[model samples]
Target chain A: MKSLTKNDLTLLVAVAFLTLFAPFILNPFPEGSAMAQFNAGYPDLMQRFVIFGIFAIGFNILFGLTGYLSFGHAAFLGVGSYAAVWMFKLLSMNVIPAIILSVIVAGLFSLLIGFVSLRRSGIYFSILTLAFAQMMFALAYSVLTPITGGETGLQLALDDPRILGSSQTPEGNIPVPGLFGMEMRDSFDLELGSWVFTFNIGYYFCALVLIASFYLAIRIFRSPFGMMLRAVKSNQQRMNYTGLNTRPYTLAAFVISGMYAGLAGGLMASMDPLAGAERMQWTASGEVVLMTILGGAGTLIGPVLGAGFIKYFENIFSKINATILHEWFAFLPDGLEDFIVAILYPFIGKGWHLTLGILFMMVVIFLPGGLVEGGQRIRSWLQARKSKNGRPNGTTEPAE
Target chain B: MDAIILQILNGLDKGSAYALIALGLTLIFGTLGVVNFAHGALFMIGAFCAVTLSRILTLSHTVIDETKTDFLGNPLKVDVPYVHDIFGIAAGNAIIDWAVPLAILFAIPVMILVGVVMERGLIKHFYKRPHADQILVTFGLAIVLQEVIKYFYGANPIPTPAPAAFKGSFDFGAAIGFDPNLIIYPYWRIIYFLFATLIIGGVFAFLQFTTFGMVVRAGMADRETVGLLGINIDKRFTIMFGIAAAVAGLAGVMYTPINSPNYHMGMDFLVLSFVVVVVGGMGSLPGAVLAGFLLGVLESFASMREVIDIIPGINQIIIYLVAIIILLTRPRGLMGRKGVMED
Candidate 1:
């Protein structure tokens, strides 16, 4: 491995600082505050933020680098979840073995799928991956019911033989996922004045893995192999003419990314310990793509941001109902309030997907570079205005 | 032998749908060079058109009847459709009864308009963009359309029944000089099959015999050359998109009686149709139709009780399995031309 550049070190530091202080940053509202509904500092959402961040980061390595959009990525994620659940069923409640097994299983699955799917590129590649995922989903839903537990998904059984540890905890209940001794669900709540912040063990564990994965991604982005992958993306015909075998490089990238997805899936199971066939669905795969693109595909931090952004809206925005809309519009006259509620009703709660779709379309049409580019545009616009007013801000351009 | 024929018939019925959707998909791809993820949504809208028309025909107002009494001994309140007053009871009843077929007429204009608006409003801008961008944008559009439908109609599947005349199954065994009760098929499925055939034939004939289609075909072959001939090909391509949308919509409209109409039905068919298009060779009309029927029949065969006993869950994944094999071995699909999207 090459030594980290100054910019890379700065990114590493920034990511560490941000993730370390995420609880405080995410929870801006005070306790018992009216705006508390907007708070995203909870462990479940935070864990999802990092877990999906890892998934998107892995996806970027394949899609952002090689330009091969595998719509079957969720199959690997699903495979990983099933593997992890099986690990829990057979071995112990410890997440280490489960995560390890997940990465291995997903890697093998992607290798098989990619070896065949990569024979074609462009839309064909996308369709092939989609078909494979759908096949896996069908299997998980029906034929592989014993392994995947069918529709209800794979769950940890109370009577299963655990050679490494007891099937049930000492309390005669199902064991929670843990790191050796520390429970994943364990949290330390700190209260100062009117505000309370929770530091969760699971969130931190996921954050650590995400940071490591992000760092590894940065290295890959700057590596010679990464350059080769980019070359394949830019002009495969030229690469072929140059006598370079692009298949192995692409296959390797696919496997690596699949493992990352598996890692994310394993972490998800560690947090929740359930794996459903829905995890392997094409929609789940599309969600990861949306995350990568929305955050700004081909960029390092963009996928993470996109993942966080979507998860936030999916969880928080979907919680808003008619009553909340009515309350927000209560200051208006009765007729106007009713009108406003009616207008706002469809874009919230169950209509969150509609909002997401519109947002995705707008992003694709106007901001191809994604949210990252949107951020850059805003910053540059602000800088231009500041310069025009004869006061220059010393802030340099942000890292890609 | 009869059982084999029955499965083949089943396959043909299934294939008709696949062929229709794939044909439309190929038309759009050939003319516009856009992979429309929203094509299925167009079909769904077409089906909903039938539902909408039926709802309109059945639009009723409450009428209080002094001669009739309710269970509680109060004056009876009866709902009477406005169509009954306008067209008379028998004609109104007929109209409502044949709403699914009548939806074809309603869907054609609506689908074309929707297609035109979709092309003008969104897809036109994406002509110069990469296929990925096109896919993403259209996928977004599809989700939006589906969600909008869900918002209005709710998430449940709405059963749009065929006319009373087509309710019974045809005894194919007796028709084929076999045992009387050996083989049977639903009348609606047969109608759906025939309707699909008509649409496919019509689309092919229009493209083959018409000047507009000739120009469109020429433009599809080489857009720059067609433009150099001082022709406005873009307008015709826009029309082609509308026609494609209509084809898909018509397919969806007729499909309602077979499977019931739901918001997500379009999405369910979308992936399969895309596979059909790819397997048929992306921009080839005949390829799309052939592959659609081929896969449809294969799917039916895979779903046979004997086949399922041999390979559990083969029914659910047979199409995708066939697609992967064909794609890996013959990258251009069954009838894919040499240069169409091979890159």
Candidate 2:
């Protein structure tokens, strides 16, 4: 029995291996060293990487396959987070029930939204999704305060009744979210010589979910349903002329992608039992879009790569400040160093969004196919050079 | 009846803003055939133009006055505006007080340059690209412009008050023989309404009467054919983009007193304005203006205590709800041409 197509299987194994050893891989610098500031082995950032990777993967399935840009996709993720947090409050601290409920709730929510938004294609669909998301965000931030917790956000409280688990631990504190026996916050640090690799249960859990999400995405990409979605993207009118009802296919894809987003949201809340309406904001939606496009939207591994790239940069860029800038350029004369720091100040730390905005524009303007396409072009070019020396290159297919 | 009248007046004020922004958005879309997400940024820049002119007019230098002594028996140092030094104190003081109105003069040329550069440097390349690409690029541009504004002017809203002469509220109801002070409104808001009407009328008149406007209207109807007729329609569209920018900027400049200008204010208005544009009919100028006022009124009505008591959060979602309904029921929009963006 064949598992995956050779290239896909190779991709899956590589991803699995990378995720398993991520603590080591992400922590390249030695402890107490200047470069250690760049290390991202901590649980919070690592969980974010995989969680966002899952989001981008899900986003890619809809956008990359069908070319339908849902500008409000983050609404589903926000809904999923709210659901999961509510589950943690009402049912149990166990992430299992929360994850399942979040997925189901997100699926139903997306179904309702998709049914309405899918009426029109192109920019109308984008605007519809945007309006719905904005509407939800406003409601969640205001009148839905009883359910959504308003501006302060929904946080797990000490009084929350976890029917399956005790309301509070023996120490008289709120029970932390956990798998039946293991707490999400549990961490283990491994030291080898001067290097420190920190690992957390939450990060591993998220990584495992990401691997599964990635695998499922690959399966979907190789499926006939995905072909129909691609066909929808290329020519919906032609597909309609052929008597195909494209709505159901597109709707189904939208729902599935929404469920994937919900899954990511659930995982996020599981790691930290809180949810904010801000997650549903248009900027959050735009970030996922940027990730998918940056990584190469249509390519199978592209979204994951894009997700990692963005989250990692966001972390790194936000950590840089004037002091760090001055440290980096300390060799320059005082005037030059001050000038350079002033020039660079607005693109780092709290101003990282500006950098993101600029990068997003550049990517859309010059590299519409994303980083994956750029890589493919380079590889093909290298092969062409080899073919000049009499070794022919394999014909390449555009990322799908 | 008084309460209802008050809400309607509020709605008209809100509608004036919505109409102005949506007018510019529709103008750009109608002429260039590009969905510009950065058009709101132009509106935002216009408000900042007012802020900037105020800042510039008040540029001052320290002068030691011999007549006025400090507690230390030293001559008092006075900060005197450069404008006062240039054109005696009274004239400079007058110019500074009227900075917001003067910004209209400054913003027109600046906004036109911005619009032309955006059209030529960025939006021109996107004419042939997919709508999604156009949206994405322009959205990115919007963020960049917003961030650039935030960097220079901090994140807080800058209060650019209307001139002192128009500072107080005007009781218009008494003039109309209603109970005194029953329908009082700000002098500035009344000015804004008249100003919006003037701008809207100017745009319509420009489009209706001028050779340039005629060429643009013809281009919008059939670009290839217009080109075939040997008119440089692209150049006119670029100028149309400039005019649209000026309109949005002027609206922004006038709007600063009504709602203090902030960097993100453009985005806040942009989403609703897009809804207004869509509901008005995608490419129809009249549709956009009609839809803008209609939605504004509807939104105001929804926010009324009576309406909110029944629908809870209806006001929050009313514009979007209306837009969704209109989009579904009338895909061609209230004033949309049949073939334009139907697919």
Candidate 3:
């Protein structure tokens, strides 16, 4: 792969800045506007978007680079969350210690899980990971309820001593995660005409971290280790015959990805101050898989796009109701209006799952390479059409 | 000794479900090379068959009882169904009593039709896809089926009680020369165990003794070779899928009384059944049956208060823990054949 050009790096930095400011940009519309409904500017959901994006990116590192599809990756995320929450409870309200502890715990957990699960390859590996995940989920829900908080989940309380920060108030307010004296949620609002914008400190913090993660991922993708991982994906037997210990490399990648998940998990609890067992469910693990595949696995930017797309759709779809459907069909005739609304009824709110299911099926069937591939195909088609229209000579002239 | 026997009987009742579902899963995997993740959904559908049948059997119409007087001093009336009048009290009561048993007849064709439709519509297209793709599609199908059921059933566990004849516990100790209460087991549970044994035996016999069975085994071993011999292997595989569906349906039908069927019941059992399949070694028939019973007994042991206190949640994770240990020690699984998922 070519090294990142200066222009490309600049573009990336600019994009990162924009993402950090996305909440402000998105909040311009009135609260009641349709676009406002799609605003991912909220603290909780924005944190989730970046956190999940990070999670998927890490998953893509293992799966995309090494071609090892892990069905149990969510277990690491769950474990990380639990670890971070425990840190908050036992130590301090400061997120640094929580995040660091979470990453270390998650890394250790993955080392053990990956060591055993990686013994087999392909479907066996997938099944093994799945078994471990289910076991963890069950354990988390039942036996470890005291530690994991069972179905109710673990949360921070006022009783927790703030060794690094002020103790949370008795009103049960969420303590804004801070570094030094700078609080993450502190933001400034700007108004212009009918539009409003809010620039949040947490958004910048998340963006800075995301950019750092992306840069590290890019570096890894270009490194010798990445080449070795690709070699493992392409022909493991060939690599083994060439005198390489593939186990350590895979284990290293697993741990790195696991730490990323821990970071995401820590961020999740830092923003919300709560960690639920439901977050560790197999379904959550499956969701990350869907995001990776949907965005185009093996591409650096794809998982982020996929995460954003799914989160966006999830927000928009769930907010839709029968009233919205009725309004959408208002322009039609009396009989046709009701018919159209009825036909569209099951794809909204609680029925949004139906839409997601259909989208997943369509993507798998038509665009196995996912949204990135779809975009490339469309671009190439447009280019072909343009060239065909421009060519008038008997001999086709190629652009240099 | 009596406690041991009672626990053994309890284990068998649970074992019956695991065995039947594992049998179905192994059948499909053995023949189709496709993991039917929606097998649990089919089981849930079968349970609903009992619920639907009970609802149908008890349908009533009202008639006025003109001879009775109300608290307001007006003539009172009672409404009754025409079936009650025509069948008379004893026969009508018998019809209601036999609702669950009669549901088997209703479930078989319906379950088979569902199986056929699922195979022909969704799964047939996925036969050539990768295992991951197949898993994803089937997993999606399972979710969709479960959600649809939830939408209709309102997410509550609906009971499907067995007939009055099978309602009470049996004093097995009396026959075995022990205290009656010490060795007692539910009559319905024992019936379920027997029914599962018969179905398992029947399935095994059919596969072992018949020409169809011979062909299916041959196809499972090598489909191309079986096809070269002019056998329609795909048809056999499709039939095997149907058989698997029926087995899961039967398991659910019998399991309704033990644990009331809910929309999410299939999901709850799915992971455990997959563990059973894996422990038995993927696509191994006898291996599946053996592992199912072994895991079932182990789960019962883990559920004991003493064991649970020692290792909390062991009951929930016992099977999976065993599976991981087995896979690590033996990558091909306990009985997995060479070259299966080797690629």
Q: For each candidate, what's the DockQ?
A: 0.89, 0.80, 0.54
Off by over 4 Å in 1: A391-400, B71-74
B1-343: candidate 2 lDDT, tens digit per residue? 8768778878888899899999999998888878988888889999999999999999999999999999999999999999999999999999999999999999999999999999999999999999889998999999999999999999999999999999998887887778998989899988988998899999999999998889999998899999999999999999999999999999999999988999999998988898899888888999989888888888888899999998899999999998899899998888888888888
Model 1: per-residue Cα lDDT at residue A19: 82
Top model by lDDT, which number? 1
Candidate 3 segments whose C-alpha is farther than 4 A from its true place: A5-18, A24-29, A166-176, A392-400, B59-93
State candidate 2's DockQ: 0.80
The candidate, 1 or 3, that scores higher on TM-score is: 1
Model 1: reference contacts kept, as a fraction: 0.90
lDDT, candidate 1, at B20 = 87
- Residue-wise C-alpha lDDT for candidate 1, range B52-134, written one tens digit per residue: 99999899999998899989999999999999989999998998999999989899999999999999999999999999999
List model 1 lDDT by residue over A1-400, tens digit each.
Answer: 2488988888777877778789999999998887888999999999998999999999999999999988889999999999998998899999999999999999999999989898999999999999999999998999999999998889888898888999888889989999999999999999989888999999999999988998999999999999999999999999999998999999999999999999999999999999999999999999999999999999988999999999999999999999988888889999999998999899999999999999999999999999999999999998788886884545577889
Window of ten residues with lowest summed lDDT in model 1 chain B? B12-21
lDDT of 1 at B178: 94
Reference-based TM-score, model 3 = 0.92
- lDDT at position A227, candidate 2: 92
lDDT of 1: 0.93
Q: Which number leads on DockQ? A: 1
Candidate 2 is scored at a TM of 0.97
